[model samples]
Target: MSAYDVARHFADSWGLVFLFGVFLFAVGRALRPSARDEYEHARTVVLRDEEPGK
Candidate 1:
């Protein structure tokens, strides 16, 4: 197969899998229970007069 054909095949298959895996990783990290406190802090920080992390 020519270079272009091989590259196209890889992109059509493994590239999709790689991107999906990355998507799952990001979703998992965001939804993990340990992160709840951090997310809640961010959600309410805008209403607080003091700066975050102070």
Candidate 2:
């Protein structure tokens, strides 16, 4: 096979897997119990009257 065809096949398979892996990692991190408090803080930080510099 030509170099371009080889590259395309590799990307079509490995690139998709890599992207899916990244997506799963992000979803897993976001849903973990340990992250709940941090997410809660971010969700409410705007409601508080804290300085923007902080």
| 1-54 per-residue lDDT for model 1 (tens digits) | 999999999999899999999999999999999999999998997888986678
lDDT per residue for candidate 2 within 1-54, as digits (tens), equals 999999999999899999999999999999999999999999998899978787
Cα deviation of 35, candidate 1, in Å: 0.5
lDDT of 2: 0.96
What lDDT would each prediction earn against the true structure? 0.95, 0.96
Candidate that scores best on lDDT = 2
* Candidate 2, superposed: residue stretches over 4 Å from native: none
The per-candidate count of clashes, in order, stands at 0, 0
